[model samples]
Target: MGIWRIGADVLVCSRFTVSPLAQTMAALTALHKGRADPGRQAWLREHLPAYRDRLAGDRVEELLVWAALRPRWLADFMITPPRDDDRTFHDELRRVSETPAEVAAADLATAIGAPLPPELRVPDLPGRAAALLEWIWTHTVLPEWPRLRRVFEADIVSRTGRLSTGGWAAALDGMRPGLRWLGDGRLQINTYDNPPRDIPANARLSFIPVTTAHGWVTWDLPDRYAVIYPCTGLLADAPTSPAPPVAVSALIGPARADILTRLSEPRSTTQLVALTGQSLGSVGGHLKILLAAHLIHRRRSGRSVLYYRSPLGDRLLKPE
Candidate 1:
């Protein structure tokens, strides 16, 4: 079984509406990171006036960090492999490299040495498009998006008309009741532009000035001071920068030399403990110090912990 499943309702809306914006934002993020695509930039200049401002400075930085980190996660499991006889593998590798979803799947497959099966027909997967929203929510919204979520939901409703497919309508109906206008409005006349006067702001809400693949959306959150969800744990498995070797006297003492030596080859707490014949707690204690010193880094692969010496740590131990 796949590690995830998107509801038909969500998959439908994601196909038509949310995915486009997700792709646009991803591309924009790339632009901010100095990976600008002239075609995308030109498209934004012709279509979205907001990019003229959002691409300026720190906004670009925030977008770059947020956009660059996600999508590949979902890309890992979105499809099953083509039947062994399907000749699509060559096309799959060649055609999908430019699209985020396909590239992500390929990357994951490379890492695990397994093929991802196609969940649907090749022509209808919309894999890159679908990856955009899933990636955004998991990486961008879930972490730093309490305020932005509301904005995105509202703006999506306002802009639902941009989609020609009923897929968007179905997805909205299945959305958290908190953000269902896109689907509900399907029965109304001129819903987004000329809504019934009685529609509440909660119903007529909009995302802030964020731009996406479908174009610009205006759904900023209502308050600035609201507490955001804590994101410390979400990235717990992520890699860290190397620790420094500046010989802080508060911990590890001269064992620092041995600790540094062992870390040159990354090891988990259990592995280190076994290697040193030290207690697990002692190994952990040394690791914390090494981490703080920026001499080592951590990454989680499944249930095990792994450590690696930082480049800085290497420079410190190298003969002059």
Candidate 2:
């Protein structure tokens, strides 16, 4: 009964703004060409490779940012559209302060103790607050600062005071980190697999360790949590053994295919075992091959290794 489970297909759209209302307005702005920026092209090339499929011909970075943020955005937190009847919503927020965005953004930054940029403040409020929000939307990925990202996420969940998804909550509550992920040696990062760029090249990456006391914190806050990134690739010297290719062909077996197929949607290993009627050892073996193939994947979800097919795996399993 965790939150993520409740909103399984809620479609958290991407609007680059902090608030959901801002995301909608931003979406409209893009449709009418109000938020165009040329620098976005370079930014995409430098940061997110996933944009390749979405932005092949158009250098429409602003629109993409607005789109991405809008989907997952909360409705009330956003800046109201000039066309909407949001005067009351804006005023309600204003009751806390004339510039609620500035206040919320500042509180988020402070809770994390990260350096605040000027964008986080209200546009008219001459300071670093305004700069910070601008930077987050434009130039950076929040997870790059693991500790700080968790702080901001937690604070947002607290201030919003919305009901938990039951799915997400259950997932976070039951998630546990283990040395050998689902018995496969491959590492798993919960929300995503990409390593945050800020981790030093020399720093050996490992799980933040679930039992380390810090893991007991409420899921309302954002932190690295079950999200993992592959640090094995970050080893100081190249391995003596040749790395296996991460192509789909490596996962060619009935059990592997069945597992990958079921994983197109997220499923706990326990769930998969029941659905597929496979032994735990066999499923674990198949998962390892898929992990090396970069096809099927596992993540720590509230002490469980939730397995799912990678985006790439989905296309391969069922080609359009």
> Which stretch of 10 consecutive residues in model 2 shows the poorest summed lDDT?
209-218
All candidates: TM-score: 0.23, 0.24
Per-residue error at 307 for model 1, in Å? 0.7
lDDT of 1 by residue, 77-184 (tens): 222221223342233233333345545445445544456444321332344334433443344334434433333333343234333445444323322212233334
Q: Could you give the C-alpha RMSD of every candidate to the true structure, in order shown?
A: 20.0, 17.9
Against the unseen true structure, what C-alpha lDDT does each candidate score? 0.38, 0.36
Query: What TM value does model 1 have?
Result: 0.23
Q: Which stretches of candidate 2 lie over 4 Å from their true place?
A: 1-251
Give the lDDT of residue 302 in candidate 2. 47
